[model samples]
Target: MTKSTKPAAKKPAASKAAPKSSKAVAAPAPAEANKVAKTQIIDMVASATTLSKKQAAEAVSSMLDLIATALKDGKSVGLPGLGTLSVAATAERQGVRPGTSDKITIPAGKKVRFKVASTLKGTL
Candidate 1:
């Protein structure tokens, strides 16, 4: 029989806990919620492509205008890899008034609906 001579591995040390503070907890500011605005998008597009900042801004604005125009004309917009944007009609329904049990009728309305593409959803 052969004798084993390998040394056993050492266990890793535990991490130290963070110290607690007595300061009052404040709600996070809205800007802290990771939001990207249009200007940032324009800049990114310009940098990624060969287009100038002005050209990039114009392109982005034009694309948005086209989408809005199509939606207004009762047409569904489909971007191959992105998704589809369409207007949905919602039926009238009953809703309860806040702070009271009184029932109220909600009028039917049209709302924009986005259906994410399976390809995009799968990537996430």
Candidate 2:
């Protein structure tokens, strides 16, 4: 009979499990934090404004359309509780292509900008 000469198995290295001393825990990402339902907004507007669901939807649509039109006309749109939407012109610039030293001219364009309201910023 062959005699077995094996060392006893050792416990896996201490798990990287956090030490219990620290009270801080990793926070959830901003996108995952405090999710609000679209239905809630619709319901609130319908109830508070005393408008039918269809009317509420139309009102919201009109507001958004107005904002879009203003921005298209080179005007800034500001909503008291929401934010400001504006169009900013980007200057043309030369950019280098990836994996190549060749330079390319990027055409100038107008881009929409959003500045969140101070109240909304605090909440986030």
Candidate 3:
């Protein structure tokens, strides 16, 4: 009788398992830090134009309200160089339930869509 002398192969580590370290996690990158908020935009507009902070805030708020109202009325809102916001109708579809083996159905819904203008794309 002949005897085989082969070592068993080792199993690979699980990809889902994360390292259990106590070190502090790193913060998001600088680009994310540079994101401008609504208040900052208002301040910029106030400084650039002949308007106070309160006036700038009111203007910004009114503009947003107008856009939202137009969209709610099933109309498209357009900003000259920015883009257009339109409402789109979606059909009903099927989806799976998370953490379980059961399936579910997702109802039809309306969604907002944005189309970037070529002028803005060139600036980017």
Q: Model 1 clash pairs?
A: none
The residue-by-residue lDDT of candidate 1 on 9-122, one tens digit each, is 222222222222222233344555588889999999999999999999999999999999999888999999999999999999999999998999999998999999999999
- With a 3 Å backbone cut-off (N, CA, C), the pairs that clash in candidate 2 are none
Candidate 3, number of clashes = 0
* lDDT (C-alpha) at residue 34 in model 3: 85
Note the Cα lDDT for every prediction shown: 0.83, 0.77, 0.84
Assess candidate 1 and give its TM-score to the true structure.
Answer: 0.72
Per-residue error for 31 in candidate 1, Å, reads 5.1
- Tens-place lDDT per residue, model 2, 3-116, is 332222222222223543232344444555578665666677899998998888788778768888999999998889889889999999999988987999999999999999
TM-score: the better of candidates 2 and 3? 3
Give candidate 3 misplaced runs (Cα > 4 Å). Answer: 1-32
TM-score of 3: 0.73
Candidate 2 residue runs with Cα over 4 Å from true position? 1-44, 98-102
